[model samples]
Target: MLKNAALQYYHTVCSPNISSLLELRQSRKSNFEGREHQKYMLVKWNEISPNTILKKIESNDVELALSTLVINLRNIRMNLSPEFHAEKILYAKLLQACRTHPAWTIACSTINEEDTAALINSLRSNVATWKAQNKPTIEQFPRRDLDDSEILFIDPRYFNSNSN
Candidate 1:
């Protein structure tokens, strides 16, 4: 009976009418452009509180939280707003904590402290490079033509010389 049930289940899942499965897979693909997807991911991250990630770190679930924190940091690094700046700093600190925290040592844990530290350092360097590249340059004064006046604003009376 069990063998028959297993065979039936396999047949149903691997049937010739697999279009449903293909459609499901395709639907999961993102239609958003790179920047839009980043914004969407940021909005999703906002739903997850920092305290929850801290709790995961405290419980030695560093691997789970590390990726999230890293991505959050990378996403917000480009934002010049004060709130985003604060969140970026918080995420970086959390990532640092993940790197220094003792290894979980479980069979399921894939990353070690050294590896986490390396990833964090790489991300920090990338962020620094991005900031340097995107830094705002001082606006240069417009070049003056030879006949242009030094006076920025001319008085109306100066134009109408006959008016006393």
Candidate 2:
């Protein structure tokens, strides 16, 4: 299971690089491009009260409430919101907590081998596609881009991004 809070931390998202000085070409069709966004609730499965969860997570006690949140998210993924990933600041805190104590994260309990593999496969393909279109040079992907060290692996972290 994945949490919305963690997704937000992914800040992995990149906005369009529209140049202010660039001239627009005349076209009958629209030039607009929409990016994807996942909306996560500020609260966690009704546990970890809004204002309080933030502080607790900062102290690393976030594992206390992360399970419920992750379960809810998994349900969302398996059922209703397959293409959406909800991310909130408070949710990020829970993610941090889960990182420190993975036994508490859904990845440890809810996520099975097949689901984990499927998710990984999807991510690899997505990364490949992104790499192809953007043509990320070796220098750009240097340690930083390829690095998973930044992510704390408590229960074996899982990141999900929803894009149309």
Candidate 3:
């Protein structure tokens, strides 16, 4: 059978080298000369990698940095409309992103609620812990009255003249 041959070829020749599926499609609108009016979308084809945000948090050690990510995810979810599959996929992506944060290890380990709020809360709590531990305390120093009499006094020797 033709199907049998195709399966055999796919398994033997194509399975080993390729790690992922490469989808190629030609745009019907390619005939248009200029594409300036077309809005370029990022997530349409490119996947947002967790490593991109992980590096920033690792470098700065700030939990607030994660807020932007949370907001972006929320926006994406809202914009995705009625696509349940896309929303679930986005949630999974966010959960994966949350794993990269050191303080979020516990939260990321358990899959209680697959939502952005839960993840954001966990990040916020961890940030609070970091803030508490690293709280900026003003160090007090003993104040001493500056003695200015010596500096104000002029040397008497300067007034004395040995000779004209």
Best by TM-score: 3
Model 1 lDDT, residue 131, Cα: 50
Q: Over 4 Å off in model 2, which ranges? A: 1-64, 71-82, 85-97, 102-112, 116-164
Q: Taking the tens digit of each residue's C-alpha lDDT, what string does model 1 give over 1-164?
A: 22564456445654444468665344333322245656765665554444466675775334445466666655654432344556435544444444433332121133334344554555445444545665698569866666456557778867867556
lDDT (tens digit, per residue) of candidate 2 on 64-135: 334344445454333223343444432443344344332333332343443433433433344345446555
User: Candidate 3, residues 1-164: lDDT per residue as tens digits?
Assistant: 32675566556755665554451112212311123212222352124434454565675545545765665565544434245336566667667776766666566776588775676676678667766766877659856677776456668777777785
Q: Candidate 1 regions off by >4 Å?
A: 1-60, 81-96, 104-117, 121-164
Q: What is the lDDT of residue 5 in candidate 1?
A: 48
Per-model TM-score, in order, reads 0.23, 0.19, 0.43
Model 3: residues with Cα > 4 Å off, grouped in runs: 1-61, 76-87, 133-164
Task: Sort by lDDT, best first.
Answer: 3, 1, 2
- Would you list the C-alpha lDDT of every candidate in the order shown? 0.49, 0.37, 0.55
Number of the top candidate by lDDT?
3
* Candidate 3 TM-score over all chains jointly: 0.43
Full-model lDDT, candidate 2: 0.37
Which of the two, 2 or 3, has more lDDT? Answer: 3
